[model samples]
Target: MITAEKIFKSFGTCTVLNGINLAIGAGSTIGLAGPSGSGKSTLLRCIQGLESPDSGRISREGYPGFMFQDFQLFPHMTVWDNILYAPRVRKLFPRAYLEAKADRLLRHLAIGQCKDRYPTNLSGGQKQRVALARTLILGPDILLCDEPTSGLDVAATGDVVALLKSIQNEETTIVVASHNLDFLVQISNRIILLKNGSIGADIVPQELEDPIVHLRGLCD
Candidate 1:
């Protein structure tokens, strides 16, 4: 499980997260929905330890893997190399073991054919898959994604959503921050609405008849 207690963050004089508290259960798929600059990305970064909160405590059982909004792939490396980078850097496993894991992940994501290609050559969805594969190679207990489908078309968004859903089992927790309300409603079991750096509502998507309308009410 992951818990955040009275979390607060700021950049210079601008406050981002303000007295935020949350408890994310294991194996749950949570969607963080809010307008731009509502601290969605900041919260995810804090949870992943990429950014530190100015105050409050965040506790979790294990480390999380973060998938960036821009699909932060190494432009100079091939897909295979990009997937192997973290494991090789940390020396988590032998080269052969990491290679085998990468091969499996690439195949599972249906991007095995693009292993030798660089990020520049792949489509938006393919790039996202590669990024996801890279994160998955580390076997994180939690996955934090920032705008996983920000620029994709409907088909591509569906593909990414499907991929995410496939990996959400009994052991991994997934938290996604996205502007795609429909996508979130489709994939996430719980939805957290944020406003002005605080949680406005915490609801189960299945309980809301019109999620978009409910979300609009909260934001407005």
Candidate 2:
């Protein structure tokens, strides 16, 4: 559903993505893993149009939604407001539809009771689910997640994993950029290792041992 060709991006003198090329098929879950400053986040931003490439091209089909590494929910807004904000602003759907979708997402994500709470009142896991509900409420065709399990504990991470897998289907493409290799392996059909602004390795996660070792080595 997304194709990036020889994508090159830089910030002043520092290059973040160099000669990046990849094609993500529809309904696939692709994981991007690497150490700090490896361009994982930068690549996701370019795909989401949050950043423009200095050169090369990125083409994508359908609507794209981004979930930031840090949950960027408005602190003043309750979960209900935060989840419905984007569709409400875009008026992409009827008010009744938006509200119904928001309600369903909150329930599906197991955060129904938290709808009345503010971000400040949420725990890390609750906040993550709320953020996910907000993103999923829009029914994005392609979901770009940055560190979906960043601050969650093991149990919470497991919950996030299950949730992601449950949402996978025949139309949505999921791309996750994270430092958590084990987590990625669990959810990603394909894992890509990024190093120094380039794709270091890309492999299927079937034989998890070797891929995990290789990915960890690159990060180290």
Candidate 3:
């Protein structure tokens, strides 16, 4: 579970997030939709603690697994190392537990064959798969994904969507901030429209004909 209230943030001359308030339940998939510069990405950074908010409190009940917009993999590190870094660094679990989890996640994500390969040796889709496996291996209570399926072919996107859904079923709450309304509509349980750095619309699955169009209206 997570709660953020009255959050305000700006970058020098421009105000990115103005009075943001949101709460996400366990296993919920909340989609953030907005125009290019509407602060969706900035809000994600704040939630992940990458960017400090000027005001408001971000209350998180447990540790989160975040997937950046770009798959930030170490080109020199082998896939296994990349997936093993989190638990190994935190010393959260036994070495055997971490290794077994990493191996299982790589296999479940269909990237086990690439375990010995360097990032440079993998394709765009393969790299993203590795990133997802790496993050999942950390066994986060929540997941923050920014434009998670922005790249890769349609088939690859589908695979990522399925994986995300499976993760959600396993009780990992997911928050995905993206400009791709169609993709968000395909995978999200709810959509929150961001306009002028504020939440303008929050629609559940049973809402109107097209949530994206309704969300776009907030930009007007």
Which candidate has the top score in TM-score?
Answer: 2
Given candidate 3, what's the lDDT at residue 195? Answer: 88
Q: Candidate 3 overall Cα lDDT vs. reference?
A: 0.83
lDDT of 1 by residue, 151-170 (tens): 77887677777778888988
lDDT of 1: 0.89
Candidate 1 weakest ten by summed lDDT: 155-164
Badly placed stretches (over 4 Å) of model 3 are: 95-97, 216-220
Clashes of each: 0, 0, 0
How much RMSD separates candidate 3 from the native structure? 2.2
Question: TM-score for each prediction?
Answer: 0.91, 0.92, 0.89
Residue pairs clashing in model 2 are none
Model 2 segments beyond 4 Å from truth?
Answer: 94-97, 208-210
The lDDT values for all models are 0.89, 0.89, 0.83
User: How would you encode candidate 3's per-residue C-alpha lDDT over 80-199 as one tens digit per residue?
Assistant: 998887678888899998888888777666777899999999987788888888778777888888877776678777777777777776467889987777778878889888889889
Error of 2 at 7 (Å): 1.0
